[model samples]
Target: MEPDSYHRIYVERTLALIKPDAIHRSEEIEDVILKAGFAVLQNRKLQLSPEQCSDFYADQYGKYFFPNLTAFMSSGPIIALTLARSNAIAHWKSLMGPVNSTKARETHPECLRAKYGTTDLKNALHGSESFDAAEREIKFMFPNSVIEPLPSREETEEYLSKHVNPTLVRGLTELCKHKPLNPCVWLAHWLMKNCPNMPQIVVEEAEDKK
Candidate 1:
């Protein structure tokens, strides 16, 4: 057997959706996400048009529940997220559990869908099924966004453990532990330090000012 040149951890990004039926539970879900150690790269809320919904779920276009699914998706506002973690695509799906809420409740009662989903069509969340789909969905939700290619686990872990994690812990600890005036001002500065290419208006404006 030949040895591979590089170790690929598939330390990738994935798209997560707080569907209309569960957008009300967004805060709770996000808390779970942070506690679970996933990094939320970006997020936005929008109401999709029926046409947009159809396009997004094109793979299911001919399915029996397609119409109702599209209608429900377009019915209210949804929160789209670009999340990053090692093994993100599969990990997010595991967190979301089954597409069928009833089955999810039966088998994975603590999963996001089991707790919040109402039905298969009105499932409380959505996760891209694969790395390719995740890239597509993240691009769809965040046009003009650039997701940097991640390094392998060996490189990431060594660097983070030796350099990144300590600094981050100190910084985040300071931010959370102290009550500062206009905390957002400090947070914006922190985000710039960590994510200089975030594609946010604030990032752009800061660059322009510089």
Candidate 2:
């Protein structure tokens, strides 16, 4: 089915990574993204440093799986992409199927990960969970191009007024004031509230601003 015209007008973007394990299956992954209506804005392959891997997975630092995850990520080269489309995050993740290759194959045989991945950690792909994460992850991976000016105060206020609830607006405003990180979660929540029936991909993209 075709995407809604309104959604097309408000197209969003997200970051997607094809891990080393999927290098041989890159074409298959690209096909999946294209079929999902996402346009590849930028793409590249790089061998990551251990420091970069650790920084990228910092959120999982305290978790038991962090060490292994870091090792796996730094083990080989990876493909990074900037994908543009409506509802990018959720859609991309859906196309990726599950984190565990075994489960993905059984439950979503046609999914990218299911077809190319060898295991859970080597699951051939990585997608930012939210727009904020996408922005951070993308910047961490592609420092040069990812750096851009933050939204101005007036712009932020206007955006909040038009798209967010008063209660949420206040919280998000505070978040911007202190954290000043990407506002992926706040943006996703806003889109969900305003466009409740939008596709998952659209929601994901909305969250992945960078």
Candidate 3:
């Protein structure tokens, strides 16, 4: 099921980038993310090529910081996470603090960047600044992400209530318990144990009738 049906209730998803500088502290940062009530919908550790990094940050092109920013982004492996929450776009950015992390440390000591970042170029995290940017960034990171250009209201509501809400509750409950070191690993085990029978949907092709 697609996940973009939240114009009314504000369930949103955003991309949170754990930049190269913070890759070493990935687990600590992830613990912070989970404790902050954000769900990790998808996670991957990938090394971006220069071209990919440039295209991803195209909006900053021609700016003074663009070249250095892109170079840093492509320098090493980084963690890309699809984080979801009630207001994920803003919430994730708030967790990341400002682009310049030395200032973030002085002002917002609890922020991710402040804890892990050394400089603006070495900033530990990246977050989508707006709703449109969130959507576009998610697509850039996950090109084959399910297309939900327009999800029917009723179906979307049904899916969320039936699947998303309950799983979130259960996930949160597990997170609160004495658990595995890795949240994603715990989730994988939970899914394998619980999902005995996955429903298979069959789309019937139309046929001519006499």
Candidate 4:
């Protein structure tokens, strides 16, 4: 195929959580996810601290059930998944059905909640509500990843060439010549001191003595 004839397909990513109540059913839930066509990009099982649970659901902090919700979430290990698909957020939301398990069973019989969830607060799974929430939740769960809305290659190259490369080259050269025991620390200090936009520290000179 000709270069111009090629088309790029972009995939969307969202965060999914198998909360404590349904943690034992993680493998089954994952099977459902894969069957529904979502690629699990990252998966981890971890127990959240009470503080972490509180922070994760910060928006619901003042609600009547907030304390109990946090307690339940921190009670056991939950599985965090980074799901990718064309519309992963909406798909996962549909899969999870209503927040209440009773409602889910009545209205959406095939949903995950209907099968595993106990109540609204103990909903078996959680899906990101929007793009911003996806980004935040994904970052919270997987700290090392770089996510969407990233700068293009051209933009990244331009920035490195204009601002970073020159200083980086000089720093590396000095690092090689001096061979400091703490090379990383030395390079960091060098870059800070030699940065193009670093603010000047103006020291006032005392007036000449009479």
Per-candidate TM vs. native? 0.68, 0.67, 0.67, 0.66
Best by lDDT: 4
Candidate 3 or 4, higher lDDT? 4
Give the per-residue lDDT of model 2 (tens digit) for 93-186: 8888899998999999998888889898889999989878877877777777845534543565565456544645566666677663567776
Lowest summed lDDT across 10 adjacent residues in model 4 is found at 1-10
Off by over 4 Å in 3: 1-9, 147-210
TM-score quality measure for candidate 4 = 0.66
Sliding window of 10 residues with minimal summed lDDT for model 3: 1-10
lDDT for each candidate structure:
0.83, 0.77, 0.83, 0.87
Report the C-alpha lDDT of model 1 over 1-210, residue by residue, as the tens digit.
011322233367889999999999999999998887789999899999999999899888899999999999999999999888778888899999999998999999999999999888888999998877887888888888887756655676676566656666766777898767877788667856765345555534345654
The alpha-carbon root-mean-square deviation between model 3 and the true structure, to one decimal in Å, is 11.4
| Model 4 lDDT at residue 109 | 90
lDDT of 3 at 180: 78
Residue-level lDDT tens digits of model 4 in 7-48: 122356789999999998999999999999999999988999
* lDDT at position 35, candidate 4: 96
The clash count of every prediction, one per candidate, is 0, 12, 0, 0
Please give the distance, in angstroms, between residue 12's alpha carbon in candidate 4 and its true position after superposition: 1.2
